[model samples]
Target: MKITYRFLLFFFSCAAFFHPIKNAVAQENWPIKPITMIIPFPPGGVADTVGRPVADALSRSLGQPVIVENRAGAGGGIGMAAVAKAKPDGYTILLALSSISIIPEADKILGKPPSYSLSQLKPIARFTADPTVLVVRSDSPWQNYYQFIDAMRKSPGKYNFGSSGNYGTMHVPMEMLKASQKFFMVHIPYTGAGPAIVGLLGGQVDAVATGPSSIVQYIKAGRVRALAHWGEGRLASLPDVPSFKEMGVPIQFAQWAGLFVPAGTSDFITNKLREASKVASNDEKVRLIINTAGSPIQYLDAPEFKAYWDADAKQMEEAVKKIGKVE
Candidate 1:
């Protein structure tokens, strides 16, 4: 009986050892199948513009197709929540935007249960940082940034600015501007940047604070006029337009997009994904697409990205507190 019991114990110990070995081997093999990159915004939007190119580049580097799937709604909360709760096996990832950092504060201000916390997602890398530009229709009387500000200061709440959504990335920066400049403009929130741009063109709103990519072509076509860019310097595509720093606003805002995986994703997989991202960011086609969107390719690896995300989240939180709840 003793000998039989010892045999069983040895067999169980071997099973335990080999089971982990198998799992480790599988993890080393990593993504034996296709991976999904969830954009959390509708197709043809800024997120899609960056997400698709990165996905294609990742597909090439990773030896597997990296498919992009858009899941748009609730100002990007739904898709982020799904990724936060998704399996952390590296198959599912998020192509998150700067808005992801603000959603938590927005939820709190709105008195809603948070969809996902910043802690729920792990940063992989950041690919692009596109500055926000305040733009108006070509025919608008205001030709420069000061003119727009003077108009708003003179008639509080007479002008309105459209944004992708309430408490979104676009909305936050505009609110900061409003707070700093002590001006008032009625806020008109749309479902996404695409819709907000449409509202601006249709005369539903006086101006829109958006990434240049969404309106660069329109600006070139003389359909819209860019007043002030919210960055450290002017965009290469629109050099004549001055940055907010140059205008004495002392505020720099950019709609940066990055890659993230569920928080508990294994280090091996995260490192692999980061390496693939590094390769993708350097791809010539990827650079062209991002540059054409009027966004500079700013890639940061996992640690740097985490630090950047944390700082940005804190800044957004304070900005939201100052702006208060936006109904």
Candidate 2:
């Protein structure tokens, strides 16, 4: 009997000791299969512009494919909730925009159930962060930034703007400007930034506020003219353009793309992703693609990304409050 007891104790000790090693080994072998990167918004948006390149680079770095899946809905809530509820195994990840912070705040303001709280996910890295630009068709009657504003002020609701969706990053900025300037522009919500741009071009909407990357091609093509951006200074790619504040709009906002995993993701996998991401984001090919598209890489590590996210979220919360409940 004493021999039996000793043997059982030895067995339990061995099991305990092996468990951590087992986990470590598993983590090391993580992503043996493809990883799903949920972009929360659809293709052709700024997120897509950066995400596809990052996924390609990350795949090569990790020796595993990073598949991008667009799960856009509810102003980006559908995909976000899926990521929040995803297992913390690193296979399912999110590369979302600053709207990641706004959707939940909008839910709270609208008195709806929160889609996903900021606490539900962990930031891995920030790939690109660019202040949104306000663009209108080149053939429009308004020739400059002030002309557009004066027209809107003179004929409230006569003009309309397209957005990705309600309470989306695009929507929030335009609404904030409306609140600040005391003017009205009918909001036409679309499925994604790509569609919003189409709407703008097709005359479905008069203008749009979008990430620099989303509209750079149109601006260069002479289909749309950039009025101004929501930045402190001009973008290097758009050196001739001016910021909204420079035009006396008194507003600022940026759209950012960042990688995130469900909270409780093991640090081993998170760190691995971070390392791979650092390389992927800095990849020369990826840089060329995005930079030529208009936005330069604005990379931020996890800690710094979190600080940036926190500040943006706080501002979003207040912006939602200011916009009040929208039916």
Candidate 3:
């Protein structure tokens, strides 16, 4: 009996050791094949800007060629929906933006509902966040947010403001501002933030509400003048620009980026991706890229990210209510 028990114990010990080793190997080789990172917006937008570097870093870390596929259309719904329907094999992920949370609300205003709910995807990590800025031509007459708001208040719907898309971060905040300030401004939605900046630069629009990533270059070139940032505080990149509150405007908003995999992906693979993202976000190269772009690399691990996202969504809903139903 004693000999039989000793043999059984040895067998169990070997199985426990080998099982973990085998699992680790399998997890490490997750993307043995090329992986796809989906950017829901067109190239040259914030999502693309942040995603490219991450893809490069992830490729090196995973030993696989990671590619960024631009699937821009339908206000980011088309690409996001693709992610929801993707196989949960840890090979595909969505570079989700703050706009992802508002798709359902925006759709409700349009009399249509989003095909896939936010719950269908698993949040991996919150990669970066950028404050929205209100910019105009450097040579234009408006000097500050108050002056701009005074003009808009007098003219109401006569002013024109350009944004990336209908439900984009830039659009939503501007709409809320108009409603709160009791003004009417015609909103022009471009395919992406790049085109919106181009429109502003070409004198096609009176002003633009965009992230610093797209407009910082022009600010540095003395081509565009920043009126105010829609953040609690000023952006480090444009220290001269004031916040909305400081400008006496009670509205604030920002754009955030995160990573997500399909809901059914294995927990181990998702954890691995999360760990890699954390490392990439903290890398010196990534920091330089974000700072040079005028946006900071803000990292929020799983739990913190969920809380932040939830509060943002709730605030958006309240803003939508106060701004009235928009289409």
Candidate 4:
């Protein structure tokens, strides 16, 4: 009987050594399958341009295919809703932009609020930051930020500005400016940034509020003049342009984009995704792509990014309450 008991103990000990239930090494082995990155905007836009780079980098890092699928419409709602409804498995993620929170505020203009709230998604990482720029045609009379404001103050509603869409993310800042300045200008909305830029280029609009990427080419060619960047300081790419704050305008807005998975994702999978995203953001290829897109790398880890988003959401809500809807 003693020999049999000793033999049983040895068998159990060997089984325990060979099979561990949970460990760091085991969790690192995640993403056993391909990942689907959903871009909540159409192709040839800012979001799509930035997403491809990170997707390629993630594919190389995880040794699995990372596909970017565009689901445009409803001002990023359709794709975002799809992501929120996807399985909580780490395989699916949404490239959330300022629009993720803006949509709710613009709801009155859109006719209703978004179907899914921020709570529906788990924050993964903040990948990039880009500021909006106030621009005008090269031959326009307004030479600088002050000249533009003086023109507005002297002849209210005489000038007009173009933005990506009606009651969209880019339009919100313009709304705030109009209210604070107590000036008037016809707001023309385009289907997207491309069309809005075309309006400015064709001399159809007096000025525009767009990002560096949309106006980089025109600004470089001297076809358009950058009056000011909507931030605390000048952009690295446009060193000479003054920031709105520096001019004592009290206006500054920067838009950011991040990654998120559907809520209810397991902690193990979420952590794995965060690790993979960090690796992808640092990849050399990703750096080149992001630089070309005109949005510099400003990656924020999970906790910090979440706080940023929360604050941004609160700010948007207040802006909406103050200005009401654009439509």
- TM-score for each candidate, following the candidate numbering: 0.93, 0.94, 0.89, 0.84
Residues 27-118 of candidate 1 have per-residue lDDT tens digits of 99988999999988777567887899999999999999999988888778888899999999999999988999888888988999999998
Give the per-residue lDDT digits (tens) of candidate 2, residues 1-327: 357988999999999999999988889899799999998887899989999999999999989999999998887889999999999999999999998988888898889899788999999999988999889999999888888889999998899999999989889999988887888999999888988999999999999999989999999999999988889988997899899788787999989999999998999899999999999888999999999899899899999999999998999888888888877
Tens-digit lDDT string for candidate 4 (1-327): 357988989999988876665444555677778889998766656676678888888888778889999876666777888989898867888886777887766675457856687788889898887778889999999898889988998998888998666655567778877887778888987655666778889999998877676577788899999988777787887889998788777766666779999998889888867888899889888887777656678898899998998998888777767767666
Best by lDDT: 2
lDDT of 4 at 270: 86
- Segments of candidate 4 deviating more than 4 angstroms: 1-33, 108-113
Mark the regions of model 2 whose C-alpha exceeds 4 Å error after superposition: 1-20
TM-score of 1: 0.93
206: Cα error in model 2, Å: 0.7
Pull out the clashing pairs in model 1.
none
State the lDDT at 160 in candidate 2: 97
Q: Report the C-alpha displacement of residue 295, candidate 1, in angstroms.
A: 0.9
lDDT (CA) for every model shown?
0.89, 0.91, 0.83, 0.79
Q: For model 4, which pairs clash?
A: none
Top candidate on TM-score is 2
| Each model's backbone clash number | 0, 0, 1, 0
